[model samples]
Target chain A: MDLLYQIFVDPFVQMGTAPDLLVQTLWEGLVSGVLYALIALGFVLIFKASGVFNFAQGIMVVFAALTLVGLYEKGVPAFLALALTIVVMLGLAVLVERLMLRPLVNQPDIVLFMATFGLTYVLIGLGEIIFGGDPKVMIADQLYLPRGAIDVNMLGGFVSLQKIDIAAAIIASLMVAGLAVVFQKTRIGRALRAVADSHKAALSVGISLEQIWVVVWFAAGIVALATGIMWGARSNVSFALEIVSLKALPVLILGGLTSIPGAIVGGIIIGVGEKLGEFYWGPLLGSGIESWLAYVIALIFLLFRPQGLFGERIIERI
Target chain B: MFYREAGQYKTSYAADQAIFPVLQDRLGLIAILIVAFVVIPLTGNEFLLQAVMIPFLVFTLATIGLNLLTGYTGLLSLGTGAFMGVGAYACYKLATIFPQVNLLVWVVASGFFAAGVGVLFGLPSLRIKGFYLAVATLAAQFFLSWCFIRIPWLYNYNISASIEVPTRTLFGIPVTGPTAAPVTRYLVVLSIVVVMTWLASNLVHGRIGRMWMAVRDMDIAAELIGIKLYRTKLLAFAVSSFYCGVAGAMLAFLWLGAAESESFNINQSFLVLFMVIIGGLGSLTGSFFGALFIWGLPIVLRNAPGAFGLSITAATVEHITFMVVGALIVFFLIVEPNGLARLWQIGKQKLRVWPFPY
Candidate 1:
């Protein structure tokens, strides 16, 4: 009985009168949603260019963040460390394309997908081996991001928002907008779309697919870094965070694998949904309901529209 | 040459139909079995036995499970870890409820629970395919993981919510828990693996296996040809989950001896999937060989540097191992999409045509 009260009833009772707690919960959800979308965007970029699911996006987040912090700890300036990290990411993109992706080209999608599984291990081993296994604090202050909270008066109560949360939302929006422009307007973007559509057609038209794959993978690495820093600022940087990346799989399902805007919308929905569930109705389930909430929502969406929010309905032909 | 198989012809179909057709392979397998059962138990170090061999045997079972679904049946799954947790939890629940039953029986029976869960989740496969199906399995992963943690009965109301293995004797020989001898535990696992892997191979080569292949090659055509996509896919899920579940139960009982909700997370699923891919999809031999290679490398690297008197940090060894494995995956993919199994096949083809151009 006491377990029920502590696990379920008390949390709900607390929520009924706690407007401030509601606002705090909403803010945290928004921050996490943006981070999830950023990671999804990494997945979306590679999927958009290569039509491969790019399972390595999660560890790329860990790898990029680990590299940045490890570089800084080794006496590189924060900004310099950031630049060096980009170079390393670019190097990795080239190495992957040259070493793995090129060989995997024209293979069955499953084989390529499995290759990413191998890549995941390589990155985990590489990341942990190069950077120590211990979780490190984000270089937030050195990166000039605000760490304080802002007081807000709303809904008949006072609420607090972390300045870092606000920065994360803004940065994610800007990055998404930048990608939207590059993919929709640029010539390289057109070629990537063409290749994503039909590799044979794209090749016959003189498009260099190898270049597009490398460029897109490198772009994913950058998004991964952005996600890493934002998420790391909220918690800590460690391989443990790799598991949370699986949550983005549901986000991809909700938003559609190939849509940039879909990732943002899906992120917000999951973020808000998880927060609301945990705050308002979590007590009903004895708390910790947020873990599967996004999946349940995605499941409902899949039943109705397997094509996703913005994706095209797949048509089979012989 | 020692490798030649001349004058070793089988006198009957039964002899030819033996598990290993080639005499040399038969001999090699016997040598390995002897090493595993006798040599390693007495001579191998703790790290070799515990870290490499035990995990290898367990994960080899797991890789076979995933390979049956993804590699053989042509279904991609992201929920393997959750199925494993179900197996582990089912064993926990069953043992708690029926304390009088033999421990091994409960562990084996736990797989049925996972098979049930797998079939339920697999219902989506009838309506969906490819990436959509993969995403659908994600639901199973999240839902099952959440259940393990939220349900108090799984952990017996422990504050930490972890399942601890209980001590038990099988035929008066300890097989699980702290007091069990390593050799006894290993032998139990080895026997189970041997039996289950044989069953999997038999199933894969039989009527059901061909039906699965027909469906994988072309589902609509297979349906037109009377292969029930619904039943076949669900059976794949059931069998695959059963294998994974048994491995998970054994993992919790015989290896870790204790586990939390986080014990069988999504990462473990991906790792198992990697083993199947790198091994050789559709080949049981590839399962053991791939598991040994991928799982064994770290141990070999950790030990080799010391043997050579070269001072190397564990981190450096780990990183180098990553680069090597990464390179090997690409090498195998480019050179042989069939994986290490294909390489082995090509070598055999060359041997059959030795010293001849035509």
Candidate 2:
């Protein structure tokens, strides 16, 4: 009975007792969730536009950040490096569409997916070769992202919030809002939606699939850049960040493969859930449950809803 | 001309149903078997046996395992490394527990443990398909990997937390551990891989294989046609994990001689998947070819610089190899998405019709 209480009740009791800690955990979760959502947003954009599950998105994030940092280290101004990085990503997008996706068009989704795996390898090798494999600090101060922490007195305890976290959340929200506006209120957005819905139909109506693909991939690249900056500001920019970015897969699962809002909500849910599970129940499991907790959460959710929260209902035809 | 099967005739159903239907094919098979069982063993040096051939065979087995599911049953699993870990850990525990028992038995038996875990994780495959199922398998991958690290009991409370392979003799000949001769370990691994591959080939050619393939082609259609999708998919998981388990056991025992959780991380899974996809999705022969190419590419690349007397640093060569391998994979995928197996088939077809353009 005590074991059962410890399993089910004690975590809640702790939460009730230390509300400030709970808030702190939630804030940290939200920040990480925003990062995860940003990664997933990149995934959703490319997946929706190209039907290619770009496994390279994570590496693209690292590559983008690496380019930014590597250029800054080369004595380029931070903002110019940032712009050059965007251009590099755009170049990458065009190269990918031309080289990988064009030839592999009409292949099975799995084949395309594997092609992205190849893309991932190429990016990793290229990134390491160019940037040197060591981790580099994100130029947050030069970029003017906020620093320090805001300590709030609440519930008889002080919950310290990192100003960087607040900036991340705000920037992530602004980016999402901007993307939403662009997606909803633009001519290019209409073409993207058309291509996303039916490639054949879009092509028939004079929308160039190739051009749209390049555009969508470039957009995904930009998202990767923004994500790289925020995530790198939180930690050192390194290839190891690619592994953490894989948390976005579980996030994608929760959010659905194609839904932007689903990606956001799913990322937050996975982030908060993983944090809470680790903080409360980690000791019971020897304290490294954070690695698999997100996956487990996603797995449980998958059992109930295979198509995910915002994904279209799957209907198969013989 | 030698590849032609013009005069061959099958007088019986059994003859018609033989795996190698052509006379040349049977001869080719026998020749390859002779090379593997006789020629290579007698001529191969310690380095060849230890570094190239054994790892190749080990990965071939693992590739076959992944191919069985991803290539045959249409279930894309990313937890192969973890399943392999289960087998390795299980083999370790079993060996320590029953010191008197044959190590080979434990290696084979460990696959069952992996199969059980595979089935447990594969339960989600019924509801989830495609990438979702892939993520579900990642759950298995991460969770089991965590278990490998956290549960010291699996590794017998070792300080380093790595499983040390105990010396095990086969008919009083040392086949594992540092004391074991590479040739002895190679023969043991070879025999097991051959037998298991034969079993796999037979399975894929038989009714069970058809069921898996049918499900792979279209699960809903297979179900409507009265092929039990649940049983078939689960059985695919079981058998695939079984193969991977044995491969993992051999990998740790016959190849690495010692292992920690790092040996079976997500990268291992991806590596095996790359072999499967690059080899050929649905061809057993492709598994061998895929393993050989993917595993051999790095060795060849690493040696090529020295062979050419290039003055490049090892790290630079390593990075270059990565680039080349990456570029080659994409090139191969573009050139023949069906994998090297299909290319082999095309070659054979061209050889058969040589001197005449059809």
Candidate 3:
């Protein structure tokens, strides 16, 4: 009976007793969800433009952050380092399109996916060699990201929110709105959508597949940079951050692989669901259920909606 | 030519159906088996046996397990490391419970536990396909890895949270644990790998293999043809996990001698997947080639600088190895996406048609 209460009722009772903690947890979850959505956004951009899964998005986040920090450490001004990092990401986008995607064109999806895995190793090796293996501070002060927290009184208690987190949430929303504009208003965006719909059809319509690939990859690179800054401000910039960024995979599937809005909604759902499960039900199982809870949630959700919440309905014909 | 199969005649279905129907191929198989069974163990140094050969074989088993699913049945799985962990933990628990049972028996039996877990995870594959299925398997990977760490019972409540292999004997010869001879362990691992590989070969060459291939080529077409997609996929999961389970058991007991949950992390899954891709998909011979290349490349790279009399720091070498391996993978994918097995076939083809281009 006690076990039943613990599993089924105690967490809710606790939530009822301490509503402020629930709100605090939800806020934290929302902030992290926005970050997860950013990473998933990078994935969606590349996957939509090209049919490739692009497993290197997580590493790209780390690499971009590492470059920003590594450049700053070399006596360059913070703004100059940021500009140089953008240039480097642009260079990387061009290199990837020419070297990796171009030659591997028309290969099976799995082959392209594995190629991205190779790209991951290369970036990891390069990042470590250049920046050393140790973690570095994100240079948040120079970047002028806010510090400290705000205490809001509610529900007979006070909820403390990190100012940096609030900034991260704002930045994420602004970037998404900007991306929505670029995607909706630009000629390149039209070409990208056409290419995404059908490679051959897009080519027949005189769309340069190569140009679109480079543009999409560079755009994704910018997203990775923004994500790196937000995520690094929250924690130390390190290769370990790459592993944590894998939280985006569940987010990717939850939002559906091809949907932008899906990614955002999925990220928040996974983030909030993960925090709630970890806070309430974690003790019943163990304290570290946070590691696998998002995946389990996504897995259960996948059972009912295989194409995801926003993915196009899959139709098969012989 | 020496490699010609021109004179070979098959008068019966069994003769035609033989795995090595060509005379040269059969001879090649015998030569390789002799080297594996007799030549290597008898003459190989301890490091060669322990560090290279045993790990190569263990990874080969895991690669084969994964290839049977991803390469054969067209189900991409990322939970291979966890399935292998299941086998290791099951073997560890089984050994502790029934101390007198032959350790080898427990190693093979533990595969059943992994298979069950594999099937449970694989249930999602019926509704999910492609990358989605892959992510679902990641759930298995992370969840089982968590279980490995969180459940103290899996490791017998070891203070260090690692499974330490006990000294297990086979026919009065110590085969596992620190005091065991490297050659003894090598021989035991070699036997298990060889037998399991042979069984895998037979499985892939039989009717079941065709079912898996049909599923791989197109599940809908296979379903229309009356091959139950669910049963085929689940069987692939069960059998693949069984192979991975045995490989994990051997990896822990025969190779590493002790292991923590870290040994079976997602990186291990990626490493095996790389081997499968680099070696060749859906080919048994490719599994060996893939294992050897992926596992052997680092050792070769690490030793190359010393051989060339170049002085470099160990850290530099490690980083360079990563870059080189990554570059080589891309280069190989670009040069021949079909994998090294295809290259091997091409080499044999060139030899057969020497002095003339086909």
Model 1 root mean square deviation, Cα atoms: 3.5
Tens digit per residue, CA lDDT, model 3, A162-276 = 9999998888889888888877899988888899899999999999989999999999999999999999999999999899778999999988999888889999999999999
Mind giving the per-residue lDDT tens digits that candidate 1 earns over A1-318?
987677667766776678678778877887788888899899988987888888889999999999999999999999999999999999999999998888778888778877786788789888877787899999999999899999988777878888999999999999999998888899988888898899999999999988999899999999999999988998899998897797787788788888999999888888877887877777677777777888877777777777778776777654
Q: What fraction of the correct interface contacts does each predicted structure contain?
A: 0.56, 0.64, 0.74
Kindly list the per-residue Cα lDDT of model 2 for residues A22-108, writing each as its tens digit: 999998898889889999999999888878888989999999999999999999999999999999999999999899889988888
Ranking by lDDT: 3, 2, 1
Higher-ranked by TM-score: 1 or 3: 3
Measured against the native two-chain assembly using Cα atoms, what DockQ does each of the candidate structures obtain, in the order listed?
0.48, 0.80, 0.85
lDDT of 1: 0.85
lDDT per residue as tens, model 1, B48-111: 6777778899999988998899878888898899999999999988887787789989989999
Model 1: docking quality category: acceptable
Off by over 4 Å in 2: none
The full ranking of all candidates by DockQ, starting with the best, is 3, 2, 1
The sequence of per-residue lDDT tens digits that candidate 3 reaches over residues B67-158 is 99999999999999999999999999999899899999999999999999999999999999999999999999999999999999999999
Better of 1 and 2 by lDDT: 2
